[model samples]
Target: MTGLVEYAERHPWLTDAIVVAALLGSGVLGVHLVGPGDSRPEDVWVADAVTVVACLAVFGARTHPRATVVVTTVCAVVGGGLGFLLTPLLLAPVMVALYWLAVTTTSRTAWTYGAVTIVLVVGTAVGADIDETVALRSVGPALWLVLPLVMGSRSRLRDALLDAVRARAEHAERTRDDEARLRVTEERMRIARDLHDVVAHHLAVANAQAGTAAHLLRRSPELTQKVLADLQTTTSAVMLELRDTVGVLRNGGADEDGLEPAPGLARLPELIEACASAGLTVDVEVDGEPRELPAGIDLTAYRIVQEALTNATKYSASGSASLRLGYGARLIIAVANETRPGDPGAGRPGYGIVGMRERAHAVGGDLRVSDAGGRFEVVSSLPLHTPAATP
Candidate 1:
C-alpha cells in the first residue's frame, strides 16, 4: 500500500490515465441514459462512430489535449442532429482538453477554450431540437476540467520546495567545513608560540654561560673546566627539549612512551660549555633555587638561549658573548654578543632569532631582541605548568 501511494504521487502520468478511464466510463453512462430511440441503421452507424471517436479522445488527453478537443468538437458538429450518443460524450473530451490546456498552456488560453466549448455545446442543442437547458446541464460538470491546472500548480510548488531544502543543506555543510579549518589554524598558531618561548630563553642562557667560561679560562683553567661541564649539560637538555617539540608533529600526542624528556633549567651548565667551545665568553649568577619547571617552560628557556648563541656564532664580531639564567616560578634567560666591525653575521639578523621568538611565544613567554652599542641581546621569560608542556 505504501509503495502504491508513493508511485502514484511521483508519476502524474499514472494518475492522469486513471482519471481519463473514469471520465470515459462516466461518458458511456451518459450515452446509455440518453438512449438510441428511433435511430435508423445508417444513423446508428454514424452515431456509434462519432461516440467511439469522442471517447478515444480521452485516452490521449494528457499528451495532446487540444488536438483531442478539436476532434471531439468536429464529431459533435457532424453528429449533432443525428443522435445524442456522440453529443453526450463531447463533454468528456472537452473537459479533458480544458484540463490539459490549463496544465500546459496559460490560464488565458484555458479560459478562452472553456468559453468556446460551452457556447458550442449549448448552440448545438438549441439547433438540434434538444433543450438548451439540458445541453447547459450536460456540459456544466466538465468544469472538473480544472483538475490538471491545480495539479500542475502544485507540482511546480513541490519542485521549488525541494530545491530550497537542498540549498540549505549545502550551506550547512560548507559552514561546518569552514569552522573546522579555522580551528586548525588557531592550533598551529598556539604551537608556534610555544616553540618560540621554549627555544629563546634556553639559547640566551647558554650564550651567557659560554661567554663566562671563555673569560675565566684565561685566569683559572680549573674554573673554566667546571663551567665547560655545566655547558655540556645545558646542551644535552636543549637537545632533549628540541626533540620533544619536533616529536609532537610526528606523533600527535603529549603522552607517547619511549619519547625522551626535554632539557630545562637543569641543563644550564652544559649550555655554557657549548658556547665556550664556540668561542664565546659567558657568566652565570643564580638567584633562586633550581626547581623543576613545566616542560614547556623548560623548553622555552632552552630554545631562547640556543637561538641567541646561534645568532652570536653567526654575527658576533669579537667572537665573544654573554649568557644569564634567572630561574623562579618562571625562567628568565638572556644572551648577548658584541658585533665585529666587518663580521659577516653582524649585518644580517637571520631565521635563528625569528625561530627563537616563535618558540618563546609558544610556551606563553615573551621574547625581546635589541642591539645596544654594537652588542646584540635576546631575552625571554616563560611560565611553568603550561598545558602541552613537554619534558
Candidate 2:
C-alpha cells in the first residue's frame, strides 16, 4: 500500500491515466446496460465526452488545484443533467481534484470551493424541474468530495510534523560536534602549559651547570667533574619527564609502564638540591604540619615553586634564595631571591610567571609576584579541598 502511494505521488500523470481509463470504461458499460430505451445515441456521446474531459482535468490537479476543481465541477454538473447513468462516473474526477486541492491549498480555499461546487450542482438540478428524489440523490457525490478533502488535510499535517522532527535532530547533531571541538582545544592548551614548565626549569639548570663546568675545567678539575655529572642528570630527567608528558597526551590520559608519578610538595627537597647543584643556595622553612593534598592542587603547588626557583637561579645576583611552606586551612608557598646589582625588579614579565598564575587559578588558587627593596618574591595560596581530589 505504501509503495503504491509513493508511486502515485512520483508519477501523477500515470495515476490520472489510470483514473481516466476506469471512468471511461464504467461510462461505456453504463450506457450499454441502459440500452436504446433509456439513453439516446446523442446522450451517450455527450456522457462519454464529459467523462473523458473531466478525467483529463485531474492531471493538473497537483500543480493547479483551484483551476482543476473548477473544470471538473463544470463537467460534473453537465453530466448530471444528461441522466443518472452518467452522473456517477463523471463525479470520480471531481472527487480526485477536491482531494488534491485540500492537500495543496489552505483550509479556507478548499472548503469554499467544495461548498460552492456542491450547491451549484444540486441547485441546477432543482431549477431545471428535475424530480426532488433525483436532486436528493446527489448527496452521494457530495460525500465523495468531502471524504477526500478530510484525508488530504490529515496527510498535509503529518508531513509538517515530520519536517519539524528532522530539523530538531540536525540541530542536536551540530551541537555535539561543537562541544567535541571545544574539548580538544582545551586539552591542547593544557599540554602546552605542561611542556613549557618542564623545559624551562630543567634547561635553565643545565645552562648554569654547563657554564660552571667550563669555567672550572682546568683550575678545579674535581669540582668540574661533579658539575658535569649534575648537568647530565638534569638533562636526562628533563628528557624522561618530557616523554611522559607527551605520552599522557598520546594515550588520552591512560597510565603507561615506566612513567613516574608527577612531582609534588614532597619533592621540594629534591628541587632545592638540583638548584644547589647549579650553584644556587636555597634555604627552606616550614610553618605547619604537611599532609596529602588533592592531585591537581599538589601538582599546581609544585609547578609554582619550580617556576619561582628557576627564575631565582637564572636572575638572582646573590646566588641564594629562600622557600617557605605554610600548611594551615590553606597551603601557602613562598619563594624569594635577591636581585642582581643595578637590577630594579624581578628581571621581566614572561611565560614562567603567566604559566604559574594560570596553574594557580586552575586549582582554585591565586598567586602574586612582588619586588620589595631588591628581593623578588612569589607567593601562591591554594585551598586544601579541591574538585580534583581523589576521595
Candidate 3:
C-alpha cells in the first residue's frame, strides 16, 4: 500500500488517467446491468454518452478542483434529469471531484460545494418523475458526496500535523549543534589562559636566576654553582608543571602515572620558597582561621598569589615583599613591594595582571593594582559564598 501511494505521488497524471478509466468502466458496466431493456435506441445512446462525459470530467479535478466539481455536478444532474438513474454510477465522477476540492480547499468551500452537489442531484431525480422513494434515491448520493469529503479533510489534517512535528525536530537539532560549538570555544579559551600563567611565571624566574649565575661565574665559583643549581631546579619544576598542564588537555581529565593534583592555596609556602631561591624574601601574615575551600576558588587564589610574588621578585628594588591572607566572609589576599626607580620589569607588557583580574572576576571576586606611595601593591578578595564555592 505504501509503495503504491509513493508511486502515485511520483506519477500523478498516470494515476489520474487510471482512475478515470476505472470510473468509466464502472459507469458503463452499471448502466448495462441495471438499465431498462425496453428503452429506445436513442435513449440508450444518450445515457451512455452522459456516463462517458461525467467520468471524463474527473481527469481535471485535481488541477482545478472547484471548476471540475461544477462541471461534474452539472453532468450528474443532467444525467438524472434525462432518466439515466438506473444505477446512479454516473455520480462517481462527482464524488471524486468533491474529494479533490475538500483536500485542496478550505473546509467551508468543500462543504459548500458538497451541499450544492446533493441538492442538484436530488432535485433533478424528484423533478424527472422517477419511480422511486425520495429518501431511497437521496441516500446513495448523499453518502457518496460526504464520505470522500470527510476522508480528504482528515488526510489534509494529518499532513499538516506531520509538517509541524518535522519543523520542531529540525529546530532542536540546530540548537544542539550551536551548544556544542560554544562549549568547544570555551574550552579553547581556558587552555590559553592556563598556558599563559604557567609559561610567564616560570620563565621570569629562570631569566633572573640565569643572569645572576652568569654575573658571578668569575667572581665567586661557590655562589655561581648555587645560582646554577637554583636555575636547574626552577627549569625542572617548570617542565613538570607544563607536562601535567598539557597532559590535562591531551588526555581529557584521565589519570596518568605520577600526575599531580592542581596547585591551590595549600601550595603558597612552596611558591614563597621558590621566590626565596631567586633572591627575594617574602614576609607572610594570616588573620582568622583558614578552612576548606571549593576547588575553583582555591585554584584561583593560588594563581593570584603566585603571579603577584613573581612580579615582586622581578621588579622590587629591596629584594623583599609582604603577603597577607585574611579569611572571613571573604578571603582577602594582599601582596606589596617597594617600587624600583628604574626596574625593567615594572611596566612590562604581559597578561599576568589581566589573567589575575579575570580569574578573580570568574569566581565572583575582584582585584586591584596600586603603585602609589613608592610601593606597588596587588589586593584581591573572593567571596566565600561564590557561585563556584562548595554548597
What lDDT does candidate 2 reach at residue 280?
92
For 345-384, candidate 2 gives per-residue lDDT tens digits of 4657788898899888888889999876878999999999
Alpha-carbon RMSD, candidate 3: 4.5
**What lDDT, from 0 to 1, does candidate 1 have?**
0.66
Deviation from native of the Cα of residue 24 in model 1, angstroms: 4.9
Question: What would the TM-scores of all predictions be?
Answer: 0.43, 0.69, 0.76
By the lDDT metric, which is better: model 2 or model 3?
A: 3
Candidate achieving the largest lDDT: 3
Question: Model 1, residue 30: what's the lDDT?
Answer: 48
Candidate 2 has what TM-score? 0.69
Question: Rank order by lDDT, top first?
Answer: 3, 2, 1
Cα lDDT listed for each candidate: 0.66, 0.82, 0.83
Write candidate 1's Cα lDDT for 223-245 as tens digits: 88987777677667667777887
Q: Using alpha carbons, what is the TM-score of model 3?
A: 0.76
Compare the candidates by TM-score and give the number of the best one.
3
